[model samples]
Target chain A: MSGFTVYSATGCVRCKIVKGYMDAQGMTYVEKDMKAEGKEDFQKFYAANRRQIFRGPEGVEFPIVTDGTAIRQGVGACLAYLYAGRELDGFFSAGTLHKEWVDGIHAAGGNPAAGEKFLAVVRLLKGNNFKLVVDTYGRNPALLEKLLAENLVDVAVMEVMASAGLAGAIFGQPLAQEDIERSVALVATAPEYRFQTTVVPVAEGGQARYLTPQEVVAAAKLLATVTRSKKNPYLIKLYRPVQPKDERLGELAPLPAAALLAYRSQARAYQVLAEAEKE
Target chain B: MAYPSVYPTGVTIYDPKKCWSGYTIFQAKEAGALLIDMNGTEVQLWKGLHGFPNTILPGGYVMGHLGLRNNAFGMQDQTDLVQVDWDGNVVWKFNQYEYIEDPGEEPQWMARQHHDFQREGNPVGYYVPGMDPRVDGGNTLILCHKNLYNKKISDKRLLDDTIIEVTWGGDIVWEWTCSDHFDEFGFSEAAKNILCRDPNMRTAGGGMGDWMHVNCMSVLGPNRWYDAGDERFHPDNIIIDGRETNILAIIDKKTGKIVWQVGPEYDTSPALKKLGWIIGVHHTHMISRGLPGEGNILLFDNGGWAGYGVPNPGSPTGSKNALRDYSRVLEFDPVTLQIVWQYTPKEAGFVHPPDSNRFYSPFISGAQRLPNGNTLITEGSGGRAFEVTPDHEIVWEYISPYWGKQMKMNMVYRAYRVPYEWVPQAERAPETPIERIDVAKFRVPGAAPLGRKKETAIEGTKPYQGSTALCIAAAEEVDEK
Candidate 1:
């Protein structure tokens, strides 16, 4: 098997993790840091692969993944490719899905008729993987249940309003306890889905609410009960603070190690509890 | 012998055995003690100065160091400005004060008055002070005041990195600062994360500092193309480089905005990241405006920063820091911002060591467009200067042996060639014959033998026995001349 190449720069932790993943797989690769002298050849190589180079601040920070022919941006995208067991050809292809869908429409006996373009669009949607984007605001519980029962989506990511105080301030709509309970009941009947809550620090007095390990565990437990499954769900706590400049917001303070460890331990405990409940 | 005389146009020409001819004052090496002439003569001009003198111009006016002083940060033991006449008399002087509390005071006053004042540790002033003069016909001086780590007052005051042009009376007429427009500058989350994590990013050490560095300012229009409308000709569109951020910026005088800038934006295209084009560049200037590189700018791409210079063993990425070999004089289109033409040692036919590979040291260098379509380049780190023809052929070359105390760091800073018409004859220094020597006859015996066979021992006979007798005969004949 031919190995891949990774172009990276100094002090990039994401690049390090990508390289580490490739190493764990026992994959051979050549790493080039474009910030070196006499590496002009590699620079040209990367430029040819990606039409335009992305310069990081300080003129460094790149972790490019390539299997000799195609390149991808970050380790997350590269891992997605590895998981799919496919090369990065379709990822950057301009209209690969459109072409595939056109051919699929023809095969479905959708004759080359007057409405062929409309049928082709439907065929394209059915040909490849796409998760439906559903905006839930005052959405009826019955409609959500019907969609869930029909297995319309392979996976669903639903945004849940946290509390009346936060919901009124953030969404400009007062959320009742009955509304949240009904939504939770509808989601609990669905097997393949997840719940996520976005926390705006500004809504909470410009300070991110800190959840203790036990509170996080309890929240995960309640979320798992609503999902009606033993699979531990992800509780992503987001902090969106109001910053003057976009650049200032780009600078994210690292989570304190103690808090991170506490969160991780709570997640582990939640997973253990879910596994035990399944048994 | 004749005494040097001055002409009306301020041009100084040398008579036989009278004054130094066809030479411009480049820089005072050995810490302002010895002056390196354009013709490669290092003449000792003064003594007992620590920092290099800032400006050396005509009319017997030499402005530089008076002595050392201190400030709030630390002891800036080598900072002062003194105006000396042709007779070596200190006519005017300024010493460092504690601080400048008023925001209305001209930035140049703070620079001239403070010893510790620097534009982010970079010596502020002209590279070759008198090479370019103010257009309005006043004694020209360039002063830089760095404001990276200083206290922020107002949005206008935040543009602390300042370069100013003042009259002889110390009135600030023209100035350029960075903070006026770069306030909107943005960086990506990843890049900002790295900067915030790195402690050295805000300090003067490790090249990154709070003060944006504004180094090496030049005034135009003392030449033929002094147009009032042309932005490049505007005596105020100063080109400055931030030593830490590796940004070459051109500031517009009218709006106090960065008219042109090249560096990493928050969302940079992938092609630029691959090329690593903007790392540690300096000495920016507009070259070949109406010529072959028309509208293209030239600069010394220092390539010194995170991955520049020698390899660091403690680097997070186990990669060696690559030293820039062969810094090129690149002509880049300001609009598309692409390199159009470039000059390197190999293409220019300059010789390097056999093991040098492709590495050429072009550190802290400068390039100037010549009248005859050639380019004058000063490879500051190499302590060498040469003239390259339009086709990149080296027409003239000179190696400076007038190594100054800064020679240990192996830098020449800046150099300039005067047209011999700029200096007044009355103020010109006398010419002295330079002694030259050849080293071919001084080789010692070979430490290694070529073959196993015993070398023939012909060493007993002298190599130049006949040449010695001929020299004595020639000396007797030279009793006349």
Candidate 2:
């Protein structure tokens, strides 16, 4: 018996896409249309596993696939699982830069085991000559140092939370200022690397204000110091607080493109790159 | 990133069997108070009755404000607090609190009410089986704004919070102002200095210091603690939380003194460490006597930013000092401060840290304990309301369909789940089970294609070791510059 069961609904373009992708891959599976002949069966299935349902902004997504061993809700999550271990253009790995400290960060409920697994995957990709991209907060200097020394990562992006002094609060954990400085220095040594910081309104005393241009320049100065060059690339991306999540942040008007351009001009010590302006 | 403009609204998911099914009422962002059924049907709408948060009283009566005050002279002031019958006729009203005059507008009596108020019968504004809010008689506790200055708390004119108990005849029989208890909060010298200088100063009302912008207030009602001789949890004592100061306190009804409290400093205690720095909190109250975890404090820890403290690197002046990225619904023993139960991203079945924001509402939200073991949460910032079982399974969910014209967003201040019988004006809709739609398969017509090209390759490019264009958009952004 084929273990795959795709619960789809009629008129669902994603259903068609998922089925088409499966057919393109020569995979066989049963397609049950919840809005059509398979409605009753889907209801029964939903009743049995309602708690496992993942409801998004729209509703329960369609083309839910069950492989006997696992259930995948979205097309992206489903295909990623089905294509696991299959060849791809490259591998993207996170949670590896701070192997040990990953367990200490409470904000994301740190998982050292998961960090180890991610590091192992990076090693597997690099050992097999596959390209790798590493995105990190750059909290752990020694691990980053090792990763850069081994030339294991092709492209590395360090999300600079703040200048050395203010980073601990943003990270939700304190680190020696020297450590943050060292991580920036290590990331600078990568074959391809850039430092990015999302400019958001910092609320204090019940009011909010965006990080001043001088503050942005202070970050650029950190990059300049670490790379020992005025040409080190620094990106200032505007913060977009997703609703219901960072709605309070959403209430604050975003820094206009003109304001961002002003920051870029002020931070002349580094190659400052601004995010795409909101239309 | 641009978000999808089109998505499902109204009742997205409903499991009637698991939910404490009843009429869900809230102030729609557009105008008027809307009472929606379990299936998202509009059972009734009181068109001209606005709500900072509307509450449904028994016998088909709803209480809200008549209209809002002009922003030029007031921050969140309402014209009057009124109770309207099923047909939207004003039954009981109170507006004799303060008479205000704004330049270019006629001077009139204003209630100055903003966030919350509770009729005598129910301790919390929400419904309890045996504790329905009296429709005709009983005192009402109103959270109102009063512009004053104490120089002790701030140098600027302060938009201070004051709780008043008015009789059925609109007489202000009792009153308690927040600034009187500033020293009770145990602020450090640095915190005190910062507060005296800023006090959460705002531009509203021509630059007023909105010190201790208290967002929630409720009575203790009859509870196990008071029954067991805890005078601090006296049935009549009031509970209030300051959004700007990070303080949840209970005021003695008789003495008007703070009898019990938490914060301004949360990191010092072990019990507080369980739920760190509940900044910008709301809807704090003792769960009514009959509900689960009765006598325990239930509050929405609106984790955004709040508090006063010493200068830190992130906040140089220590104004609005505390911060957290996610929200949590906490039920804790007010005395021991032991967290009894909570709902965070983990309970919502999302991984922590990364998916934390999936369960956040930084400001303006609330929670209510249900008769069953579930808790109804109003994540008002997103205009989302839902009931979750004690195990944190979301049994029913509703997203507000009304978006405000001026705000251009649907943001509910608070929502309450009341028994269906409370509003007899409309017949209860069928408790149908609305299954969660497959968001993956759900689509808006004329939307972008669901499938991308199998290969988005830059053809004939020279290869380099470990080279991949994962962030093609970022590359484009750099090229644009």
Judged by lDDT against the true structure, how good is candidate 1? 0.44
True contacts kept of 1: 0.00
Report how far residue A172 has shifted in candidate 2, in Å: 72
Query: What global local distance difference test value does model 2 have?
Result: 0.76
Give the least accurate 10-residue stretch of model 2 chain B, judged by summed lDDT: B466-475
- Of candidate 2 chain A, the 10-residue stretch with the lowest lDDT total is A99-108
TM-score of chain B of each: 0.62, 0.92
Q: Supply candidate 2's per-residue lDDT for A32.
A: 89
TM-score of chain A of each: 0.39, 0.58
Residue B399 local lDDT, model 2: 88
Per-prediction TM-score: 0.43, 0.59
